[model samples]
Target: MTDLTGLTIAEARDGLAKKEFTATELTTSYIKAIDSADELNAFITKTPEKALEMAAASDARLSKGEGGALEGIPLGIKDLYCTKGVGAYACSHILDGFKPEYESTVTQNLWDAGAVMLGKLNMDEFAMGSANETSYFGPVKNPWRAKGESVDRVPGGSSGGSAAAVAARLCAAATASDTGGSIRQPAAFTGTVGIKPTYGRCSRWGMVAFASSLDQAGPIARTVRDAAIMLKSMASVDAKDTTSVNLPVPDYEAALTGNIKGMKIGIPKEYRVDGMPEEVEANWQQGINWLKEAGAEIVEISLPMTKYALPAYYIVAPAEASSNLARYDGVKYGLRVNGDDIIDMYEKTRAAGFGSEVKRRILIGTYVLSAGYYDAYYLRAQKIRTLIKQDFDKAFETVDTILTPATPSAAFELNKVVTDPVEMYLNDIFTVTVNMAGLPGITVPAGQNDKGLPLGLQLIGKAFDEETLFRTAGVLEQAAGIMDAPAKWW
Candidate 1:
């Protein structure tokens, strides 16, 4: 029995290098685990034969003494990332049958590092929903039960499948995207560590764009070090993306130190909103105390314009998404619906392809970006976004990292939030600021709420300083320990 569940990528790589397990054995175990976890609805498409073939090649390379760090390490690439010859559908009716010839930089980078592709996981349509229930394929059920409950609950979205799959050991890790908490939210919900690297740290080329300015690729894995290893492998410079940075990539796995001596952690005073749950607040305060015990200095700070982040992001992200998604007419790519005329074709195509929430965002975005309203809305949001970034800049000058809740409330019931659009958007209250600032942010499993569902403490870092963010998160994760909330879901 290959029982390497919850093993970090670094651990797996070393074991593979030592010939403790052949790539074929590892891939076979994971394929079986994924098959067994079908009730979770975590996968949209799987490539078992392709995975085994890749594993055999990796085994040969190891035999020839030419194996790479990630040779044959199976990874679940989120459906949003384009994999060559693999379905790159975004769990939407829109991009049905969409397969891209070119590999997304993130996917290509992972392939270059020698990871075997397990399959594409499911997600919310256009990455719009807070819960995975909005995915066209179906919701990703949390692998853990809700406290003492019996019913299978949803893992968060739109990277819900990746989080659930990783938690359940379906893949060693998953490549997930975070625009407004897609990666972090699901990670928190499923008791896994997920990171959203600084904007452009991982190239966006080949990633199906949801919100161009905010969408960034990152790793979702079991442990902090595992995430670090996978993140290093997935990041690279690409000529295809205009925003790509040509900077040297860091050895993230090599940078892990379990010590946080003299590290300054800032606690934003304003994040203690009036409406916060008592248990959540206590968990956060406990996390602050844990960092203090870990030899970190806790300082009070303020991100004054934080209140505007959610509204601003809702406006800006949708505006960008609206423009980017305009290209998906039924004629060119994806699901097509015929109509009587050209205008009718466009309308019919969109109606058939886009989910209701996606359509709602498109309408909101179009309205906000309308010529008469651009200055009043879109431009103002842009200016606010700049201010949000500036707030982080000023705060980072005083502290090495900022700590906040990953989400305002723990994972809510399915569709409990979907009825009210604003309520659902508010689920991202604690996460949107990091994206707005274009800085690195990570969710560390903090503790459970009174209901005892998992909660995560978020740490924000300087631009491109995912090193610091992970280092700090690794410290917290070890101290806070694993979430025991809802065990039956597993």
Candidate 2:
């Protein structure tokens, strides 16, 4: 055996069932890799003991001919999702000691499918920042290394650790959440494939709230096929989450027949932002050209409300985050920087526990939802959100999918734009719209930059149309193929 590090979860399961490798061996290898790759700081908590136990159970199930899609496959879960009896920090200091009594719906679904957890991956505290530098534990390092570049670039945010781990072969695949650009940005940065399904597709029952309206959980993996398999296990309706719709989950994997001979893909004009790198634009055009060559009709479409998406998302998401994160008071089961009075205690705890970016978001959120500003900010954002969704709804009327740049550029060096909050916010421009409209989107490694860093292209689909998204992405992915670069391509 060459080693199980690079295999996908589905491939690993098949191998495990065939007795090609034992789960114990595979999980142990990941534990070793996690330890060895300490420079990345990708994981907040690496749990080899839990992984071994889960692997043992999976092997038992396989012996009984009951192995699931992820039987014994190790996954690095993003810290935002709540895990039972284990630390589920949202990468925030305030939630330092907070352990959920129940598992998040997404986590539970993966667990029920027999996925072995490697550990909790790091993220921006409460998914607030773009760079992984905002994490309380430390910033996650991009596994890629470009020649002549001595500095380590960020792996991308919120799900940065997940992408870096998978890229570094620390785990086969990892579970990630996408509120803004979290999953896709990190995946792009680390040269992995990540999909963000339509909002409400995956149950958010126990996911530690970031931005309630936009928060969604998805899978980050090395290949689109693997992503499709994991996504299938993730999408389910849970009664516990009121936002979850009662729609039948699609057979996403089956949709990957590798045939897109008669699909209509829309190219949104609004995505051509000013000052975008020529290479990124070229990558997007190449992706479109490739898909067109695969027999898909390419149509240029206009999404007029696109510019409003970022601004609207900023208002609505932060507003909801302020409300959702308010529970982390001193009375709750988390860290508390004590003070003399109750209000003082609350203020001190929040001021001490939260990072600067988190506090900034909270302040912005509070102001948007505060007295007399609701109509101008929150209400207006809601209207724009509807318009964004409507634009997609209308576009889908003429096309099966949409094509755009996942980000304006490739991954940045650590702390390159962290000091400029506005610059960091611009990174989410291409991604936040999908969340606002509650549509499924995906990021695939399209091409590399001049310096050999991975450049990602995005595919957007209709509501509950993850099947189309995955199938289309799979077709495009087959055309794009793997990004094989030297270790120095970072």
Candidate 3:
């Protein structure tokens, strides 16, 4: 039989429907593929036994012609999401051996739709870093390497493992979240499609919190259609999450009609940051040409508040993160260290549990939210966030969606910028604005950089308008052609 591991979710679904292959066979293929690709370090935990069990159940459902939308499809769950009886540590040492008794709403939805679990994918600790390097599990290696270079490139993060696993065909697609560009940036680096739906599009109940206001869950897949399919199953309103929107989740896959006739696409002038690589700029222009050719009227628009987005995001996200992560003080669960007293124990546990990057953000957050600094830092950042939303709101009034580069550059070597936190944070320059504004955004693989590394173009849509993003991204994906899989060295 053809390599079952290489089939997209759509193809596998059709094949399973026709009884071309049993779900267990497909699951077995992925299990073997993942076993062979260990060098990528994408999965922090492997659940082959559980996966086969799930796939066997899916096979039963399929045989009865009662399978759900994602029946028999295998997916990699990000470690941040809780899976009952499975480790869900968010790739942080602090949450060592944390196997939640409950499942995350997102993963539960996927299973409800018949999706099979491949295992937990790695991510940055608490989803705090721009690159995967900060993960206690170690950085995820991007499958794509620069031309003639031996250095392993980062897959991008904190959704790095999700992107890499999809790119490497370890799973059909994977669940990923974005807070300041975690999903889209890594998708760009690994030549996959990732979407950060409008804030509250997916329930955040069981996903480990980083920034409550900014974190949104979505999918990273090999194709835009696969992403659309995954998002349909992953998104739902939950009473457990008060922030989840009550609007009906549309058929995102059906939105990809590949027809964008007369749609107005906005080109934000502010996204043209200084010192951007020429290839990224060229790819942006190329996307513009493609959209124009597809009958989209390209309009140059200004989001003046864009300049403040990164700084404002840093303030607001860390502030919320500081508050959210305080629950992990070693008193309840996970890693704990005994101390002279309660205060000493709290100090020692946190000091030993948190990584440097997580500590840095927590410190920044605490500093910003402190008594004197609240108004000057956190409050001001919140105001800037409002202005940034207003900027996007104003632009959306004229254009159906806005376009930008997914990242400042393609994947860089691991540890290249780990030394400079500012440089590391800059990786999210093109992505944080969407989070601040609570808008839906997607990144589609567009072209390869000079180093032969993949680059992606981003499309941002109005609040709760992921349909437009999927539609526009379909057009771009078609125009760009299929990206070639990286030459496997592992």
Candidate 4:
């Protein structure tokens, strides 16, 4: 038989329906692939036994002609999402030995649609860092290496493992979350497709909290169609999460009609920052040309508030994080350290449990939310966030969607930016505006940089308008052609 591990989710679904192969056989192929790709460090835990059992059940369902949309498909769950009887550490030492009795609403929806779980993928601690280096489980290496060089690069973060596993074909696709640019940035670096839907599109009840107002869950997959398929199953309204929107989830896959005749595409002039790499600018122009050729009218627009997005995001995200993370005290279910009394215990446990990056964000968060600085920092940041949303709201009046580069540059070597936190924060320059405005955004691999590393172009849609993103991304993906899997060295 052909290599089952190489098939896309759509192809595998069709093959399973025709009885070309059993789900167990497909699951076994992925199990063997993961076993051999250990050098990438994409997974924190492996669940081969559970995966085989689930695939067996899917095979039974397929035989009875009663399978769901994603029946018999294998996937990697990010460690931030809780899985019953499975470790969900968010790749942080603080959550050591903590496993939830209930599953995250997102993962539960996937399972309900017949998707099989491969295991938990790695990520940055508390999803706090731009690169994956801050993870207590260690950094996830990018599967793609620069031309004629062997230095392992970062796959981007805090969804690095999800992007790496998908690029390496360890799983058909992986669940990933974005706060500030976690999903889209990593997907760009790894030559994959990732989407961050409108805020509250996916329930966050069981996903570990990190900057509650900004965090949104999505998927990283090899193709745009696969991403559309996964998002359909992963998105739903939940009674447990009050923030989840009650709108119906449309058939995202069907939205990819590959016809964008007379659509207006916006090019934000503010996105062309100083000192940007020539290749990134060229790729942006290339995306514009492609869209123009596909009958999209390219119009340059201004989002004046773009300059303030990053700084405002830093203030607002960390403030909310400081409040949400306070629940991880010593008296809770995670790591604990005994001390002289409750206060000492709390201090000792937090000091020992949290990593440097997490602690840094927590400190920034606490300072912004403190008594004297609340108005100067957090409140002002909220006002800036409102203005940013207004900027998008104004732009959408003339354009159906906006397009830009996914990252400032392609994947850099691990530890390259770890020393300067400001440099690290700049990685999300092109992505945070979407989060602040609560709009949907997607990144599609568009071209390769000079180093032969993959680069992606981003498309931002109106609130709850992921359908337009998929439709336009389908054209971009078709024009760019298929990105070959990185040469495997792991």
For model 3, the local distance difference test gives 0.94
- Compute the lDDT of residue 421 as modeled in candidate 4: 90
Write one digit per residue (lDDT tens) for candidate 4, span 1-490. Answer: 9999899999999999999999999999999999999999998899999999999999999999999999999999999999999999999877899989999999999999999999999999999887788899999999999999999999999999999999999999999999999999999999999999999999999999998899999999999999999999999999999999999999999999999999999999999999999999999999999999999999999999999999999999988888988998868688999999999999999999999989999999999999999999999999999999999999999999999999999999986745679889999999999999999999999989889999999999999999999999999999999799999898
In the range 33-149, model 2's lDDT, one tens digit per residue, is: 888888888899988888999989988998899988778888999998889888988898888888789898988899998899999999888888777888899898899866567
Candidate 2 CA-lDDT value: 0.87
TM-score-superior candidate, 1 or 4? 4
What TM-score, to 2 decimals, does candidate 3 have?
Answer: 0.99
Give candidate 4's root-mean-square deviation (CA, Å). 0.7
- TM-scores of the candidates are 0.97, 0.98, 0.99, 0.99
On a 0 to 100 scale, what is the lDDT of residue 205 in model 3? 94
TM-score of 4: 0.99
lDDT of 4 at 359: 92
Model 1, range 253-275, lDDT digits (tens) per residue? 76678889999999999798888
Worst lDDT 10-window in candidate 1: 481-490
Candidate 3 lDDT over 26-66, as tens digits, reads 99999999999999999999999999999999999998899
Question: Ranking under lDDT, best-scoring first?
Answer: 4, 3, 2, 1
lDDT, candidates in the order shown: 0.87, 0.87, 0.94, 0.95
| Candidate 2 lDDT trough over 10 residues, lowest sum | 481-490
Report clashes for each candidate as comma-separated counts. Answer: 4, 4, 0, 0
**RMSD of each candidate?**
1.5, 1.4, 0.8, 0.7
